[model samples]
Target: MEHSMYPSMTKELAKQRSDATPEIQAAFKAFSAKVFADGALPKKTKQLIAVAVAHVTQCPYCIRGHTELAMREGATEQEIMEAVWVAAEMRAGGAYAHSSLALDTVNQVKSRSGA
Candidate 1:
């Protein structure tokens, strides 16, 4: 059955991209490995961060991949939930931070209109 919207298309596209540019693919793979490796932060912590970032980015593929990776790396459900909450807070904070731009624009418009 040829499904138009195959769920595995993410993997297939990644494979195709890697096949088309092995060097770039290798570099990315190496970089990702180094980033996720245990150093100051534990692997489980890194995976939890990734899961949180995936949630913030709203990437379904990344969310699934990192959630599974976090689980495999021994992140508990509570920890994952906390990470998600952190992401939520950060996402909202970003919008709140950008509200300064809106305030500035409003002030400029008021000044121009002598309001």
Candidate 2:
């Protein structure tokens, strides 16, 4: 039986992109490898951060990829969940931070209308 969209579609598409542009793909892989390497932060911590960022970006592929990498790098379920919570908080905080812009705009309009 052939399914319209299989569960592995994302992985298959990613592989296709890598095959289509091997050089650029290889460079990205290398860059990501270097970025995630253990330095001031450990590999597991970096993975957790990646997972959090993936959540903030709302990228399903990235979230799955980084969550798996995080687990492989020794991140516990609790750690992963905590990272997700942090992502949620940060997303909300972004909206909260932008409220200042809304406030300023409202004040400008009110002042212009002499209200």
Candidate 3:
């Protein structure tokens, strides 16, 4: 089934681009290379972090891309799952934290109105 959210490029076009667009491919290669260049974190850890960011940002393309890269970088399934869970928790916490401002405003308005 075709997803309506993302445009479906023609298979022939995709193949042709895959085969012929050296510059386009090099851009992506440069991006991936730069993402792993610093030794601050191990490659697997960085890839897992990328996967977690993808999950939190809700980018299907990035999630799929990073998941594969993480696995290729030797991230265990457990590590990948943990990263996803961490992202979920952080997203949930962020939403909950923001709700407090609304609650505080409501409380202040109610106190001012004596209701």
Candidate 4:
């Protein structure tokens, strides 16, 4: 079996982590429950958003967990794929937008060389 730098997320590991900090764990659980609860946005919508954000954040665990959750919350495969595309666009857009830094350096170098 290939071992990864990131350990597999198991319920036992989760319990061990939570056992180390029960109070914080409870608080985090409450926060997660509240965040996932239906509000102005339905659970399905939230899960889709989570899926997109997870992709952008590059968290494999979150991608799997939230993809499952999104499905459970009635998000279709098409919708989940759309969300991934959205994330891809946003991630690419960020790099595209930040290319201004390279442009700035180019202009600066050109000015210094009087070219």
Candidate 5:
């Protein structure tokens, strides 16, 4: 089997300037502003949360934005790295927790089906 470092984006089409209508831009800007609100949380906390959420969501744009924000908010390199690790741990835990439910379901199915 062929292995790739990242999920393929080949099927994902890039947008041209003409492809972006004014309404689309406005909507995107509004959504982003709402998600990354102004001063709703402490800058440092917000940056860390943003970084963690970015990692969890697997959003490269969010990760880059928040990594910069974290640095600007006086977070040390070590702190930023630790925050990413924390995100990784939480995401892995969530996956495992959910998988346990699936495992239980499989077990129940096996018992009922006499597999």
Candidate 6:
């Protein structure tokens, strides 16, 4: 396996975490279950959204897990790729939109210098 910044998910580590914070773990599990359950948004749509969000969040584990869940929910490869493309655009768009801050600073400097 390739080396990763994140540690391997050993059972020992899982048990250690759970042993330390059993209540929190249980609450988190319940929250995740409720969030993923079918409601207004179907499970498939949720999984696809998860895949997209995972990319935006840059979580490797979530991306892989959600992509699999999305496929099991009948999301096609094309659909997954398209979702990724949407993520890419949103990521780029955030930077593009935030450029207004830099531009505003430049305008402030120009005004101060009377240029």
Instruction: Give me the candidate number with maximum TM-score.
Output: 4
Cα displacement (Å) at residue 42, model 4: 0.7
- Against the reference, the lDDT scores of all candidates come to 0.93, 0.94, 0.89, 0.97, 0.80, 0.94
Question: Residue by residue across 34-54, what tens digits does model 4's lDDT show?
Answer: 999999999999999999999
Provide TM-scores for the models.
0.87, 0.87, 0.75, 0.93, 0.66, 0.90
Error of 6 at 101 (Å): 0.9
Give the Cα error of residue 79 in candidate 6, in Å.
1.3
TM-score attained by model 4: 0.93
6-111: candidate 6 lDDT, tens digit per residue: 7777899989999999999999989988998899999988998999999999998899989999999999999999999999999999999999999999999999
C-alpha displacement of 25 in model 5, angstroms?
2.3
Worst 10 residues of 3 by lDDT: 2-11
Which predicted model would earn the best lDDT? Answer: 4
Candidate 2 per-residue lDDT, tens place, 1-115, comes to 7775435657788889999999999999999999999999999999999999999988887899999999999999999999999999999999999999999999999999999
Q: In angstroms, how far off is 19's CA in candidate 1? A: 1.3
lDDT score for residue 84 of model 1: 97
How many clashing pairs in candidate 4? 0
How many clashes in each candidate? 0, 0, 0, 0, 0, 0
lDDT of 5 at 112: 100
Model 4 global lDDT (CA atoms, 0 to 1): 0.97
lDDT of 1 by residue, 10-109 (tens): 7788889899999998999999999999999999999999999999989888888899999999999999999999999999999999999999999999
lDDT tens digits, residue span 11-104, model 5: 2322443255757867887986676565768777778888988999999867887999888988888888889999999989998889989999
Error of 2 at 46 (Å): 0.1
Error of 4 at 13 (Å): 0.5
